[model samples]
Target: MIAIRLRSSCGAALVGVLALATSGCGLSAELDRETNPERKPTPSETRAVLPPVSATPSPSVSVQPVSGCPSSGLRFEVGRVDGAMGLRAMTLSMTNCGEQPYELNGYPSVSVLDEAGAPIPGVRTAEGTDEVPVAPPGSAPEPFTLKPGETARAGLLWRMAAEDGTYLRVAPDKKRDFVNVRPEEPLDIGPENILGTTPWAPAS
Candidate 1:
């Protein structure tokens, strides 16, 4: 009877140990799934979670001339002056902003003016020639037409002078109305009092 009871007790303890070992394996597998879930994201799910991105704006294009277009449909501007030794040169540019084509065949008519807008006396204006080069040699003026948005340029040459000029009165040609343009720097046409101008040519 004593030997039978000892065998039964041993048998019951072995069953309990086997059940605990099986349950421990299932618990370890559950913990692994919770700690490290799979990382596969669907395309729709990704789009829904991310914020929408805005597009960058493009730069604007400039169509108007440097100076505003005027009622005459032309814009006139003086380029920066270039000086060496005593010779001073600058570019005179005109842009056609009108619908009609503008004609040009000769040098622009220009005169220096005082602060009161009166023409300064004793200033000699002449056409530029090879003998008296205004700017580096460029193609001579020929009859040309500038359509809308086209530009023409001319060279102005002078030397520092005794009388300082506050403004320049310019006409596209002798026939057109004069337009007043203030030079970037005041004009100091020296004692020679000469201002030479090249004929209108297309801007290269």
Candidate 2:
């Protein structure tokens, strides 16, 4: 079974429930019944025919940082919510692994998924918030620049219709898409301290 991590938000849960309606398992059964309801058993039905299987291996994923961020070694952690807020948020922890100081300007993107590995529509970034800044309150907040071997924390929030698949994604900015962070990397989201928990995992 596919289990998605969720918060107490009623809105996210409502979206999850609606997603269940379009799932494949039930739809497949319904299609079978509709197509062959009046057919009688044939000799072929009694014969066991094992289909040929291929030996090719499935693709494997490795946890890697987006290209330029490797030197910064930024890591993310997510928390559970109490209910669906028109907005969803998570905290990001960034560490500077390289000798040079790093400058962090924007927040990452977040995506919610369903059991079938499809992205839940209606989820987006909240209005008026470009990206949560790392600058402190009333700090005149010069651009956030972490020194060598320094660590900083920031919050990344998004506006989503609902929370589904126990999975969430934190991605880099659009111009930085070339950073190439692997989507399957384990995030420090609360409750399992596990990695590779993407919604795209094979169905149970």
Per-residue lDDT of 4-68 in model 1, one digit per residue for the tens? 33234445556787788899999987876786577344355444566443221112311123356
Per-residue accuracy of model 2 over 76-156 as CA lDDT, tens digit each: 444343224343434444455667665555444554443333345544442123332321111112256667656654443
- Tell me the whole-model lDDT of each prediction, alpha carbons only: 0.68, 0.40
Clashes of each: 4, 14
Q: Which pairs of residues have clashing backbones in candidate 1? A: 160-190, 161-188, 161-189, 161-190
- Alpha-carbon runs more than 4 Å astray in model 1: 1-67, 130-139, 190-192
Best by TM-score: 1
Off by over 4 Å in 2: 1-72, 80-89, 114-118, 127-142, 157-162, 177-204
Cα deviation at 163, candidate 1, in Å, is 5.5
